[model samples]
Target chain A: MMTLAHTKYIVLAALIFCLTPIFSQAEGLIADQKFKADNEIFVTFSGAVDRAVAENIANYTVFEEPDPDIQLELESATLSEDSTRVSLRFKEPLNTAMTHVVSIRGLAGIDKTTFTVSKSYLGYLFGILISALLINNFVFTKYLGLCVFFGTSKKKETAKGMGVVFTLVMVVSALMSWFFYNFILIPYDLNFLQIVVFIGLVSLTVQAVDTVLRKVNPILFNSFGVFLVLVIANCVIIAVPLILANNNYNVFETFMLALGAGGGFLLALYLMSSVSERMQLAKIPPTFKGLPIAFIVAGQFAMAFLGFSGLQIF
Target chain B: MANDKSSMQLITRGILSENPIFKLALSMCPAVGISTTVMNGIMLGIAVLFVQVFSSVTISLFKNLIHPRIRIPTYTLTIATWVTVIDLVLAAYMPEAYAKMGIFVKLIVAFAIITMRLEMFACKESVNDSFWDGLGMGLGFMVGMVVIGFVRELLGSGMILGYDVLGFKPLLFFILPSAGFFVVGLMMAFFNWIEVYYKRSKGLK
Candidate 1:
């Protein structure tokens, strides 16, 4: 046998070599914590429901209460069986203590089921995007941003111009909101001041844009004259920040939401313009000249979008 | 020359004769927005009322003081300052309502109602005349919002002031932006229809 000192040295070396993997494992733990902090809890229906039924359930916020801190990621329903199996995934980790009941209201063959949460960040992100774009759309569901929509939709040329302007404005506003919310508002514990801050920013941005446009290109400025001014207080500017805060999206996901909202705004404006142009040639009744006919057309369009509510592409 | 109306008559015209969204079709932005619920409509109406009355009074009072070249900017700044104050107050004490009202509160600065009233009436009238014009126009706007809100909340959500009223199932479509368009359109048509019926009955050729 070797001397005791020699054996001790060998034992120490062995311990170091064995403990290397454990020390390296600390990095993984950090990643897990980061993931847990960022990840949202989403639940996907696994079986026994059709895709349409599941989608309707997702859009139904009637029974589901609103939670400012918790973001609900309504995923598209996937059907595995003969229209029997349905599943949903949450955007964040589900609270094991709280049970989520998916109520299948008025579906003949569908059964009401409860879903368990699984830890998947990818699933949650996808579900959040779907929910944002379709199920609980800011523009469509809430009627939050109609001023821009109507103002832009009056003319096709103006609508395209407004679309470009809106996208640019949304991106800039979102970045400002993210920084303000994370750094200033949250740190100072002045969350109540969000509305004031966001509104001030929007007003300033609009005034700045107006000044620059008027100075640089009088022709373009005149073309956009009234609309440019009108867009300053447009709901999209203020609402996006509130939504980002409510949903608690990270930088990347926040960008996606901003993009989706901008796109949705453009979509509504474009659709309205096209419909209004068509109505111009059609003989609308005298009483429904300007706004009355527009409302009826909008109602029909809303009904059409309801079909997309059931799509679970994500 | 005989058709020229007095200041009071002109002010009344702004209320009913030249109603912005309904009759004159001037300011569609605020009318279409904030009409989703009674609370939102009322809050917006109050804000608009305050801004319109004050802006009209101030602009009328200082109409000659403002340089013609920069009058628009001066008026905008004045309106913007008041809007900022209102925004802060709502955010502080009425957080929930503020959240619900969203950007429309800020949009008051750009709302053609205040600016239009300033340009059309206040800039050309006495302070007293401008005040009445603002009040009448503001009330008209409030009426429009309330009417739209009543129809939308009643049909779309089947509830009023968060209380169940009609017992009819909520049509989710009505609460959406598309439904706003529909409701406003129908209301406008309905108003026109009534106007036509009354005109015909009174034989006002």
Candidate 2:
């Protein structure tokens, strides 16, 4: 009897030991770190963190990964109403180029978890580039530039030319819009005028580029110059500036985004043109031969591109 | 009586023969992008209609003044101005409505159909004719959008206008972005087949 009772107690203890991790995992605090801006970090805990511990600035230590000696001065830590999230504001902008580490010192059950901001500036820019190029392609995913895309993509040579010209035009026009938006539009309290101003700016840029390209390099202009006018009022060109302005991206971020978008457009145009060149021979019903088939083909491509979604590339 | 007959024909033409989405196929971007739900289609359709009509009238009123060499830019500016005015007016007068539909108004600037109508119909026609053309084109586009949305929403979500109808999603693919192209493509083909069959029955080419 003594041996049997001892064996039963041992079995109970072993079961409890096996289930301890599961219980802790369900109850323990999990911190999700997100960079809201250069100077703001939002940390969301899995469970409600204690109000005093979360609000205490001393409980947190933030520093750039490369330079741990210089601790960032946490100006204020604002806890959300439910105590699940906390907003930590710093005196200076955290160096986005480097990974940032935030360590919670005295939370009750959390063992001084040092949560690191996952993506650095380069990583963030890369994310944007990949996202624009593959995940959320302007042409395939967002459905911009379809008119120009369909019009010019019938032939590979024209498609290639249009793609290069489009990238150049997009990059230049996006930069100009950025300069105008930051220097002119914001300072004068003319936010309401962005649509009109962006349209005017795009038209001016295209015209100016047309003239300058024709004068500077006639051969280059002749190859793709005809497409310059068509670029104006193109949704893709207009969307980049509007997006950058809305997100308040800085100069470098804007440049990267424009490059990615332009590159993505070019990639899409090239792929579609290649497929269409081969599709010239495919037999089909008369009704599905032209634009209808093109759309269906595009739908197939869109389905293929959908595989790239939810990919983490950092 | 002749003027009245022509006016009626002009308006009805946009609705039937020259329907923007089905017949002309000018603005496929919004038709494919924003026609995921019936409400979205209606809202965007109304915004496009407002901008299209106003810009057409404004351009038609001043077509003679615009230089032929720079008319494209002028047309674009006119469209942009109308879009801005609509945005501002809605934001000021109807804050709640603006919050829902304001973004659609701004996107009107880039829609090809608006500028296409301005160049082809409005600039060449008189103000009264331009108004009718805009209304017809707008209504046609709205009808096209509603049809696409109705089909997509029905198949995609098993619901219509947020109400569960089918009890389960039929074809989940219809809700995805890729399905937009397929739906539009199939719809276009269907329309083409109908036109051909109708012509055959009427003893016309």
Candidate 3:
């Protein structure tokens, strides 16, 4: 009986060893390589890259001319055990060929890490939808643009108009933030000025959007622009890009985050407006008449959204 | 601007008549964001209280010196300076709290409560009145935050002050931002109900 047990134990150990690699292999690492210019490539190996190859590649760069516009700043670089993947960062965009070279390196004994130049259009769309409704939820997560959110949301029709305007403003603001951050700020190495720059951008964007909308479509713009100015200085627009920057999400992810934040703002506004409309008729006490009740309602809504915290749908 | 009674009245006004979050509906920014937990609410309240009192006192003392045309700019500068000081202190001493609070600390500059009080009361009132008004409003805001924080933390985590008070599992919905609105609304309704009951029983006014 003792000998039989020993044999079973050995078989179990063998099975565990065999199964471990299969499970580990199922989740392949992704190596992302970005080309900023003709001479510079930013390589990030997510899963596993060969340590020797990564070191060799770094040494080769020392002898080579540095690519203009692609100032390599190693944000973080890591190599997994077994020398399967490597990740690196560059300050600027790289040309496509370097990315392809990194991809080939993965195939050469390193674990295969897929590198796609651009995310699918459908992926972008889906990401936008999800981001608008969930991930970087504006009202819930950022507490931005609340003045307009609470102010115009007192009535349903006004709330609807404000919601549309807020979303448009957010999209415009996000695009502006992206342009400023990527084109000017990052290039100039003025990332520390992000807060001031983004806030100014948001204020300018709101004013520009207001002016354009008013001229192009007066009726619609009138409905929305009333609250647009109010939300211009609000932090939601700038906060979205700040979050995207921290997460280091690609353009697709940034778009999604914008969508989620916008959607979340609209959701909060709609809910608050509907409740406030109902609340208008409710017999509230003199002391707790207007703002007090609104505060309480806002608190309750915030609590309700807490349910979505652990949801890993993203 | 008046005697002790008026000064005392100005102070009391913020606690009820001009309560920042509840009565006046100002400074909803930090109120909603940090009211997720009781601890956050308390910390934020104390921070705001400190800033408000000191800023109000400063504004009142320097009110005559500030130009009328540039009063808004000067007020903003003053508030920003105070906020920056708070920000630095928090960054140095309470790094964890500072990390969690994030940009909201800097946002104190734009918080309508501090600015509104500075413009409306501090600029016009005596130093003592301004100080009391700031304290009252700060306390009122604190009460608002604590109420929301208590409900959110309790229902969301099945705990109060981080202690599991109820054996029952928490309703996760109570912790999200949406729930912040709901909890605040329900609490307001409760407060309203209590006030109504008292008024009806006493036939007051």
Candidate 4:
């Protein structure tokens, strides 16, 4: 017969596993609506915190509307048994359409971040897509891909082609490299070999693509030509794995980043090329005829994108 | 006697005629990023100078051993190894300088000029020729960095090498990327005009 203690441990482990997904879906201690119950205030955190952290009492603060002008009375502050939910019962139940803020500080998840949405993985990935694509665009804001940004941006058609190639190559290669990094290099304590490995991976991938395309899509490959070959040395191609590793982005986020970065790169490239094409007609000085003029234009673009810095989407 | 004269020409070429930044337009990425401060520019330039010289000489030494098909990858690996060494040594011995130029040092591996030199001059020439060429290119790169850095630093913060040049700073925009572009543009124009005027004076095309 199975021991009673053994059965209890198994049950607890299963419960934790099931609750983990739902709990981990929160960004932070989001003020959630208390299931149609009157006067009860519920604040749901994303993941299970150390119960000890919740017990600290000082880490939780509740403020009633008006932005720091008033403070709400907490009648009973109860941490859920699983430490995933915190109930901050107001002195009186919320009856009117009122606004309040629940400030949580210094609370870490059981083993991860409070912002990782573990259950609605798709939605989370979408946010990352938008974030990387627009908010922190690789070229405009982050300043990666400067070489290709200027190199192929002279003409609109070439820029578009380069953008498309960059997106496809970066997206596919980033996934493979990310998997290799997290699974192998990281475990073996050989992360110091990142530059060598990352460059090697990219070169190998572009080569594989070349051979595969030659075999399967000879016509398309021939049409595209040497563009794919040039990607091996593009700074951003190598920078992808480095950035992903530095941020320790989850798999979904990595995928989103690759897509978003590539998309942003394409968008920036297209925009830059059009702007420069117009600039060609402007009577620029002979000295500033080429790259110098382009740099100035790039600076203007950087300033325009800086406006996106104040966004609070994350 | 002819070899000495040719080596002299090689070193001078980078400083003026074949200047990497103003003329050839190589390694523009780091040129803009590090030129924000004069000290940063000089430090990064010196680091590049070292790597460019060593890598060029090494590539020249092993030119025969490297296969044509795999030369690009071989050159990259060589540059990358030297860069890593420079990066670590800087971090250990010159923490203060490394603190600022640390990221820039690693970035040297990807510098187009270093590899361009390897392909254009190093593999094609003897080790002795490669050394002078590397020095010229390295000096040219350093000069470009320092000049851009000087203008940016002096104008942006009213400082040069950490010494304040102006009473109160003006044209603060020079420090910004927008201003960086303009400075580089104006400088390019200035350099080009000088080159044109010099060539015309000498009655050469």
Candidate 5:
């Protein structure tokens, strides 16, 4: 039982077990950092570090990037159980919009890092809304749904009606598709069929809207009925669901995207219709009279819309 | 001989007389959205070509089996299937191009051009004729995309296929989304003018 080979094996096993902790905690660099809250930051080191140096409040400084002279006071520095992460709490909340920096002195391998506090939920939603509506307006910027955009935009009345119907269809279909994608398709591993599924959903949504509108209010249906069917083929309606799915957006975010896109389409249609209604009078060239001229005018609108790029809503 | 001549005419009609982008004004979205570079235009062009031809032939062969009441949905199903095939092939073979194209590839199902051709020509024609028609229309679309890409790249970036020929950008505006509309509109007007002149000369003859 106490042979020399067996003793050698036991000694090797014991040595390996004893060396794992030291090997695991060999590196001393900061591994990761998170801007957890306005008044708190969590910095994780690659390995176990010196606790005395990490917990010292005097060694840490936090300040906005623009002004480095006025440093925020650190209330406390606490080390985690593993001694690899340190939480730095400040006396005051950092500004959300400003770029912030955190520096640690007397730490050998920790480098300074910059971060910004996460946007609030409402702020994030507002950003998506304004982004879709103005910044990345589907009609002018992305060149989506131009078929209906140009078709119904000849007259303001028709444009407004079509816009309303299109918006209603877009929001409903987008939400329905999002539900199907997240709940049914993803669980079943059927993402490849999203195109077929989304198109089918859009068609069904349009048909349902058509029937319900006719029964609920015949007069309103008569005015809006023609554009309801066309909503099935509109790329904007399809694009919204695909985008939401691609980005893994939740229900409210999907709603906001759909609403913003629909609103942007409506605004573009109304504006184009207003100008085209007047454009019927001022055209001089024969070849460039109808659609060609309309395109050039739309190009100008696109140019103007480009100015909305990088606009901060929140 | 007559069938051959008609086939030739069918192919040529889509390119010159009834071009999808310029003449029919269908599928304007992709023409502007993806034609920023020559390579992008060609890739989408080839993808659409395959989808168009395959869908056309399938719908033509199965036109009788599909019910008239629900033909639109059936046609959409066929197109979506072909598009899915292309989408997968591209994703597997060319990840970089697929990344650039993004959702537009999936949105091919909503492309008015494919469905319009299926409804207008494929359903009514023989399988052979439908193939020719699809090939012609697809080629016409490809040609249109290449030309737009050429102009945009040449003027916008002063380069062609990543080659810096001009050494300096010309307008720099042609690459913008607005310039896509402008170029397309101007080209449409130019074609209109040429058509008018051709008609006037023929009347005199």
Candidate 6:
């Protein structure tokens, strides 16, 4: 445990070392930015500019900061209907729950002037942990990682094995995706390639895990078997990291999220498998015998999980 | 080549015979995630339909170029590219509905159904056949989502597509995830019951 903690910090330091230069120039002088509930973030400048200039200002936001917590990424900018405001649309919707602080203080908007808007919303760390595990379980709530959960869920042993494997794989993959995304993708200006890169990273990691397990412990390797290959497409494996990177979790918070999500997946899978295994005895209709029945069972499990919605520890 | 009847058959098959979610159980993730509301289900269905049709046709168009050994990766890469582009384009261009679908739209990349179609039908089949199959399967998925979404929305919230027809919450559990499972299960059973009745009425079984 001590060694693990040490290595994490070591890695974090190395990552920050690589990322420092990327943030050197863009000290985010908040200027001429306005937020809209719809995906557009419109920046009104005092004067009008051509499309090319508007595009450049929007593109600059892409590499401005490497904060993983920043929810929105500027996909492109276009002139609004009035042709006065440069409407900046993001890759993802900005989280309305939090206030956005645009740091581009010195950077010029269409107005070619500097202005700032800041709102502080405190994110209690513990709140995130509880939320990830119970309220927003990747499996039960979000329905991610359902393929493997259903495919391997028929039998208790396979379900248990996949659960454990998934948990371990999710934690490691989350960290790896976070590291590469923050250090490499942001600095190198390949932010748009995130989905492809993250999926690739997950598949590669699964392959690596297979090879290591085969050499280290043959017992575990055979037990994991084809499910390892299946993990590549499991929504939770890629989605967790995607969620983490999008939320811009710090190392510790990301780790907690991984642990929470993994635990949630395991819990949901285990509960479903155990109950379904027993449910085989119940009399049922012919068409609903297999997959349809499983869906219903899953809905029941989801209701049980909904009970956790009020668990606001933070 | 087969007649026009075959194409109609292909399209209808997706709606019932080999329905992706209910019968085959290929991609249940989206079924459960977006089915909480009828609008969400419809929106996601349209998105999947667009992605599925394009992916199916693209794979068939480039079937020869993609090496058999690396086909899975190639197919995935293709799907990923389309999904990313669509996700961004929708978010930028259509802000309101885009906000509703959010990341669930991008999650289309991981859908086992799209990838399954590429491997099972798109690669071996001709362009026309693959196109029809993609349409059928995509339609099947969309219908399945709408059914589940409609059931959940009506009972869970006592509303359909944001309108409160029920005037009060029905079961509340019906809309929840657990209820989603039961609702899907019942629908599957209901469909199955229809199949049996149809066959019996025709003196087939």
Model 6 chain A weakest 10-residue run by lDDT: A113-122
lDDT of each: 0.66, 0.84, 0.67, 0.75, 0.86, 0.76
Across A1-314, the per-residue lDDT of candidate 4 in tens digits comes to 57998999999898668656754433434434332234555657656766766655466565544455565565766788888786656676553223345555666742322221121445556767877777777776655567668888988988877788778889888998899899988999987777677677787788888888789988877765567866765666776677788778767678888999889888999999999899978998776777777877887887787677634332
Question: Which model is ahead, 5 or 6, in terms of TM-score?
Answer: 5
| lDDT digits (tens) for residues A169-261 of candidate 2 | 889989999999999999999999989999888888888999999899999998888888778757888888888998788777788889989
The C-alpha stretches of model 1 lying farther than 4 A from their native spots are A1-139, A144-148, A173-230, A238-254, A307-314, B1-11, B26-40, B68-70, B88-107, B152-178, B199-205
Better of 3 and 5 by TM-score: 5
Where does candidate 5 chain A have its weakest 10-residue lDDT segment? Answer: A19-28
Expressed as tens digits, the lDDT of each residue in A1-314 for candidate 5 is 56998999999898678655533422236676656666787788777877887899987777776688989899999999999888988888766545456667667544543333334455777888898999899999999987777788899999899889998998999999999999999999999998889888999999899999999999999999999977877899989988998888888789999999999999999999999999988954988988899889999999999999967755
Off by more than 4 A, model 6? A1-127, A285-287, B1-5, B156-173, B200-205
Q: What is the DockQ of candidate 4?
A: 0.44
Q: How accurate is chain B of model 1, given as a TM-score from 0 to 1?
A: 0.89
Off by over 4 Å in 4: A1-128, B1-5, B99-103, B199-205
Question: TM-score per model for chain B alone?
Answer: 0.89, 0.87, 0.90, 0.91, 0.93, 0.88
In terms of docking quality, how is candidate 5 classified?
Answer: medium
* DockQ per candidate, 2 decimals: 0.36, 0.47, 0.19, 0.44, 0.58, 0.44
lDDT of 6 by residue, A80-178 (tens): 665457666777765433334442223344344333322211234456667888899888788788878878888788788888888888888888988
Maximum-DockQ candidate: 5
By TM-score, how accurate is candidate 6? 0.73
* Alpha carbon deviation, residue B41, candidate 5 (Å): 1.1
Of candidate 5 chain B, the 10-residue stretch with the lowest lDDT total is: B1-10
- Candidate 3 per-residue lDDT, tens place, A1-314, comes to 99999999999898677545423322244444433334344455444445665544433221112333433443444454555444444444433322132333434464433334332344444755664575446676567666556677788888777677777877777877887888898889976555556666666677788788889999877666677756644557656767766555556557667767777887888888889988988897676677666766766665566555533321
Q: Is the docking of candidate 2 incorrect, acceptable, medium or high quality?
A: acceptable
Native contacts, share recovered per candidate: 0.51, 0.70, 0.39, 0.40, 0.75, 0.69
Misplaced by over 4 Å in model 2 are A1-118, B1-5, B89-104, B203-205
